[model samples]
Target: MQIRLGGLETSEVAALLAEHVEDMRRYSPPESVHTLDLDRLRTPDLTFWSLWQEDVVLGCAALRELDPTHGELKSMRTSHAHRRRRVAAALLDHVVAEARRRGYARLSLETGSPAEFAPARTMYAAYGFTPCDAFGPYVADDFSMFMTLDLADQPAR
Candidate 1:
């Protein structure tokens, strides 16, 4: 799959992000849903990427710079039809590499704590992201699960 830097203007990418927001809302309260909308994803500090094979978008993810040494993962989603095919993994690998390249010492994320998000939690764990307390603007919430990875020793791809 070829990972493009930005494709939010395309209908396919927009729909995928909308579906991601909808899915997040189904499992978490409105206030707990941290999924960024298209406009938010376009902000200056955040870089959005979509993984595509030929013309079809398989998944998408974003990396938001919180500061010089920190970053946050956002809007990670694999299209329903492409689930379980490592679409998220590919996007994740790209995001992590980008973060490391940008000199970020830490990368963190906040996902749902519901069982529906277990697969995501497991995947993050497999990538060496351990449970952590809230970071950035997030506060402690039962509906949220926080995980962080230290990138100091992470080998570059």
Candidate 2:
């Protein structure tokens, strides 16, 4: 699989993001949905990436710069056809490596608190992301679970 930056223009990537948004809505209330739309993911503060196997999009993820030393993970999703193939893990590894390269002292993310999100929460925990107070523009909410990794303590890959 190849991980490419800025593939959001492709229909596959757009559909994948749309699916992500739809899934988020199914698990959370409208006001608690934090998923970014396609346009927002294209902003300057965010770096988007798509994982591909030749011509097919396998997954996608984005890193948003909250500040020079802090970043947030967004839009992480694996295609339905590609689920359980380690697609999300590969994209996550790529994002974490890129964050460390960017000198980010911390990497954070917000995911649903519903049971449907348990697998995701487990993955984040395996990556050393622990529960944390809301950061960036987010506030504490029952529908959202915040997690963070202190990159400063992580050794370079």
For model 1, what is the alpha-carbon lDDT of residue 13?
99
Tens digits of lDDT, candidate 2, 36-56: 988899899999999999999
Give the worst 10-residue stretch by lDDT in candidate 2: 148-157
Residues 1-157, model 1: lDDT tens digits: 8999999999999999989988999999999999989999999999999999999999999999999999999999999999999899899999999999899999999999999999999999999899999999999899999999999966664
**Candidate 2: residue 142 Cα off by (Å):** 0.7
Pairs of residues at least 3 apart in sequence or in different chains that clash in candidate 1? none
lDDT of each: 0.94, 0.94
Stretches > 4 Å off in candidate 1? none
What candidate 2 gets wrong by more than 4 Å, as runs, is none
C-alpha RMSD by candidate, in order: 1.0, 0.9
> What is the TM-score of each predicted model, taking all chains together?
0.97, 0.97
